[model samples]
Target: MSAIRFEIKLHSCNDRFNNPAVRSPLVVEVDLSGPRLANDLFFVLHDDTTGRTRLSSRLTGLGLAAAVLGELMLIGRVTVELTDGWVGLALVDAAPTGDTLTQTALDHIIAEPSHRFRIWLQFLARTAYTDVAARMTADGLLHPPRGRLSRRRAPVLANTAAWPGGRLNLAIQRRQPLNLQDGVLLGLLVATSGGQLVLWDQNPTYLSASTAALPAPLQELIAQTEAAVADSVISRR
Candidate 1:
């Protein structure tokens, strides 16, 4: 199967983020066409090597829910409304998403358009992590570890799950222009405060710009995710 490729060209700019080499219309071709956005986000958040995330389940679940919302928005099934300081969501298309999880989410949004974004995030976070993990297991991206030791040895697990993180890490390190999916990946990382794990040891310049490149809806989603997680942390303290 031929993988889909995206070519992103960076025009000359005076921003401190762009290195000299990338200033002259640099073109970057990247193949970020693996799993869908939500699946890829779950794999990146779950530590395949350790079978756990460094962050709390609360944060990871919120991030996963946000990612799924992002996927829905990308396919025109949903939209985030940011009017003034208020943020909420609405269903764009009543057509079935062809996936149960997202379809259910859309249904909820359709049923009650008044619920704020944070409310939906908290509600979905209740199950997004486990649900996505189960989906990945069914799709062959993860193998249910049989025991403590099987965490590392499970077939079709770690390597596949780790690929998304490694791929995004390399993109930041190499200062490549990120596609929409990759941009969202990085944004979600920073949103979940997991940037230090993957964005660590890279040039902060282009990496910052890459995330800032996300479209309006996505940028709003990440911003809301960050705020929601912050509130959770504060309440815990």
Candidate 2:
């Protein structure tokens, strides 16, 4: 396979007025509207230096799985059942989700509606990494790995990859109202170690406010992801 390159129009970050220190909304012209939450989550969690997910593969996979389900909820394809304090995913619609990977996940949920949201996370995490990578690679968000044996997907365009983090940071810092998708992205960031590395300045107020707008199931999804990541860490210790 051949390497592919893409160009992103980014305003000069060197301009004093546009400095990232000011958290100036990244002045980059990229049509990020079409991509799904999991796709943006992948880029947000991907390491620019290593071209790998910033968290352990297991944790990242679970995060990505949550992201995909969150997307389904945002699009009205899925809903959640609340039992006491337990949350389970419920398939609200069987229509095509428009993305095959997301649709596949939806199918799994539809096939087994009895699974807990946490179990769904583990099941989806089993293939979320590669499934999402192939989805992005097909969409051209990922550059093909340099080596035949490597599955690492560096961004095709750095600015495009950086846009997710910039958007989240600006939203939190500026106290801008977040849409459900950004809310889920923010939740996933908090669920994984990505929060410390990406958004070093954690704002509990912003998190509480943002999460308040999310549905109960989605909120529980983030909590389950956090617990799963913590369990992974404990097992590693």
Candidate 3:
């Protein structure tokens, strides 16, 4: 239910970058190595048919937040700890994440004295959509409508079927082993929304098998986040 609140917070944001929009124009920074976790989630969550996102901003936000956290976990930038019977985040190495969005998530966790996962999830989820979308747009992976008339519309990507998300979904569906980064990506996607939004004809059994391939700690984290996402979606339905 608290997870549902996280989704609601993300959906309620009408202007994703208003607070940070006035800063400057976007500059392209293609990783070439691969899409960042947030960018991959954006590509996966986008709706090709509608030129909008398939998942609500909330779900997308939570997914992105989870992705950011997962990325950090993979890089040894952060880790979770049990405190007073609650799982909270702990800083591992304060080194820069290179990517701004991931750094922001790290900064948020570091700045706040409290480390509750849900609290950080809610904050990052609410903010990640705009940051990730802007990065994708800058990278030429997505095309956001221009002009004041389309200002309120959500961003969309073209030829999404050819994007990295397609490969990720294929890997999951085929139950193929993924490298650490992809494994984290798949686990985060599955955890946040059961990969329903990302994959067509989602098979629960297949998802379970794919998830089971993750490292034990990552598996537990994803499973917890997945339960929260499920509760949020079910409540809305």
Whose lDDT is greatest here? 2
lDDT of each: 0.71, 0.75, 0.62
* Candidate 3 structure, TM-score to reference: 0.73
**Model 1 lDDT vs. the true structure?**
0.71
Candidate 1 residue-wise lDDT, 186-207, digit = tens: 8888888787765545567776
Q: Using alpha carbons, what is the TM-score of model 1?
A: 0.79
Tens digit per residue, CA lDDT, model 3, 34-131 = 55666666666666444466677777788787877877776666665555666677676788877777787788888884767777777777777777
Estimate, for each residue in 76-158, the C-alpha lDDT of model 2 and write its tens digit.
67766654446677665678866788888888888888877788888988999999889888888888788999879888888
- Misplaced by over 4 Å in model 3 are 1-32, 149-161, 234-237
Error of 2 at 114 (Å): 1.1
The reply for model 1, stretches above 4 Å from the true place, is 1-33, 83-85, 145-155
**Model 2 whole-model lDDT (C-alpha atoms):** 0.75
Clash pairs for candidate 1:
none
Better of 1 and 3 by TM-score: 1
